[model samples]
Target: MRHWIWVVAAFVAITPFTVNAAGAEPVGSAGALISGKSPDGLGTWTVRYQHFDGNSPVAAVINDRIDDAANHEVQHATWNGSTRRPWTFDATGTINVRPTTVSEIFVGQYNTDEPNMPMQSLGSVVCDSRSGTVITWDNLFQDKTSGLTRLSAEVEARLAPAASSNELRDWRRSGQFAPIDVNFKHWVATPQGIELHFPPLQFGRGLKIVTVPWASMSDQITPEFVAITE
Candidate 1:
């Protein structure tokens, strides 16, 4: 539940494109719609995307719409370029909308960037339709003290195999392993557990996703989130 302020100027122009995927149906003026019965057979969900432009003509435009029929909730994600410089934008990844005992969640990943700059990883965006909650990295822990310590230890153990000996030594020497420092923000929920995402340079040459089972860190997670994982 974050609030965003968008200011669109007159110079900007928007062109709509229709998406026709194999199993997708087109919703009324919305870009595309994809729906299915939940795995448990208790509910239904839909995902839609609308094409829109930013304030500037060169800006990137992409939006996501998620509907949780069982929970009667709707969530939206919108992204556009900020700078006037030449840019490249792509939202090509899987959009997973699934239901748990008490909630429906949506997760997505994409890439975007401008010239000469490193590719930006729109790592993962997750929405909980039941509570209308948007889970960010900061919300994962109960308290910064014990919660972060355990998280850092777990993450270090998982990433150690991929790091060079020198890199590992440097990380240990710094004695700081907070999620923010390591860029541990992108994440998604799976049937088995919650998966943490780390982009290139954060760990190794390419993207990395590490799954920490719900039972392993049950103590650190908030009460509300436990149901979704179950």
Candidate 2:
């Protein structure tokens, strides 16, 4: 099973509204949940991490919200706090998806402790899958409240279309996998949050996805904070 994480980077102030979609059912797959609705027929979601840091994992639950696209404002999010055990992270923030103009998604959380801190460059990683085609760059995680600067990381995903069809069968039969690398670029505040990028890699199959571990910091925003944004 593959772990799917959304990347949220937009923040806008507005009244919260509930997203209600008629005749919709809760989605079960990452692909479906990303493109599906809540079981309650709303546009919001409630996801729980069953086994975050464990060797074995359980299922994650997703609820619905009143509205679908509210910049940086998540409707609902939580962690069971038990399933994931000693380590756990969860959130309920805004989610945005614009397939036509941009196949991009963003989620936002407020860091109140500190703000206007200096930025720093962390590091990067390479994807093991050869069929994936996605890359992620994270930089705004300082403190949920203070918003200081401490650590940051980037992930680059490159995909091969042909690998999508056979990825399931291939990974299941062979434990060994292809490799993809992520590298740190720089930190700069702009309309698009902290700006950073990594060089692309050529893979033979599936799309690659990556994120910085924010929940790991005293105050930071991980890919879970942006899970619905990708």
Model 1 per-residue lDDT tens digits across residues 59-87: 12113222222112111222233222332
TM-score quality measure for candidate 2:
0.17
lDDT of each: 0.45, 0.25
Candidate 2's residue-wise lDDT over 138-200, tens digit each? Answer: 223333232322322122122223346465345424522222112233121222333333222
- Number of the top-ranking candidate, with lDDT as the measure: 1
Global fold similarity of model 1 (TM-score): 0.56
Best by TM-score: 1
Off by over 4 Å in 2: 1-45, 48-90, 98-132, 137-191, 195-230
Clashes of 2: 54
